[model samples]
Target: MAFHLRPATDQDLPFARALTYEAMSGYYLQYGLMWSNDGFDVAWAGRENWLICNDNAVLGFISLSRDSRALYIRELHMLEACRGLGAGSWVLEQMALKAQALGVLRLTVFKNNPARRLYLRSGMRIVGEEHCFWRMERVCQSS
Candidate 1:
């Protein structure tokens, strides 16, 4: 199913936090990710969060930060029902277009993220490592 993105505002911050906790509680504990309010600080969400929605309702949120150099996807989470439905691939395609528009050759994904496979399938190849994350890049050809 095709998905849509809506820029999240400060008023949506609390919803973002709640959704993050709901979607990631298991993975967070499994991966020993710091479960703290610090990560969801208001300032951070205001800047990075964007809601992923469809005809039914809001599904999840993605945190993206971009600059002239590269587009950084801080996080991408979806509701349980959205899993295995090709929604993530649709979003990745959109990100690739954004990268191409900006003329950047660098994009990265966390090595441990389950979505790494999706990234690899979408044309981004693992290029390097930094800490626990793997940097990736794919030439963004016009679609």
Candidate 2:
């Protein structure tokens, strides 16, 4: 089945946060960083978030923030069953299309996170690093 995206609602925040913790806690642990939910509500309320779905089921969610220079991919978390199914790559492509005017699509991934492979495969290159994260970006061809 093909996955689709829908705008995230307040009801989706719990699922998003749970999936984020499930997907990211290991990385945080490995990097010796704490996983904090302190401001997730405030941050989610302020960003553009979407739920990735297939049929009637949500597979994951993505969060985005934009500025003059680029569209930032704040979060992309999928259920374990959805991983390796091309959903991440598809989301990156969609984000790239949305970012054409800005000319850049950027995200940060944990230094040793396996999802780095997905970003690389989707045309994102590591341009720099900050602490335990790798800053990656894909330059979009503006129309």
Candidate 3:
């Protein structure tokens, strides 16, 4: 199935929340930690959330924060079915393009997340790791 990335709307909150919860639950199950809906809701409550959809079904979502110099990838989650299918790479490419357009220098990703492989493949490198997360950055080229 083909996937597309789009700016998330308020109407997409329910779907986004469900995907977030599912991803978190999987992580909790894998690591034996408690996953809470409140945590998901709070993380997505007021951020710039983007939806990865195909024919109206939400496949994944990502949230980001932007500063003058860089964009921080706050959260990214893809359904288990969508993992390893290039959907994650597509989303990261979109994010990188958006950052480049904004004249941002780089984007950041956490270390422990499996998505680190995607970031590295997309040319981001580990700059640091803190709080159990590996921070990565990719410099954008100027026009």
| Candidate with the greatest lDDT versus the true structure | 2
Off by over 4 Å in 2: none
Q: Give one digit per residue, the lDDT tens place, for model 3 in 58-106.
A: 7788888888788778778888887888888877777778788555424
Query: Looking at model 2, how many pairs of residues clash?
Result: 0
C-alpha RMSD values across all candidates: 2.8, 1.1, 3.0
Task: Arrange candidates by TM-score, descending.
Answer: 2, 1, 3
Q: Write the per-residue lDDT of candidate 1 for residues 12-108, one digit (tens) a residue.
A: 6777777677866776676567777676774465456788877657877777777776676666778778777777777777778877766544555
Off by over 4 Å in 3: 25-36, 102-110
Assess candidate 1 and give its TM-score to the true structure.
0.77
TM-score of each: 0.77, 0.95, 0.77
- Minimal lDDT window, size 10, model 1: 102-111
Residue 88 deviation, candidate 3, in Å?
A: 1.0
lDDT for predicted candidate 3 compared with the true structure: 0.73
List runs of model 1 lying over 4 Å from the truth.
22-33, 42-46, 105-110, 141-143
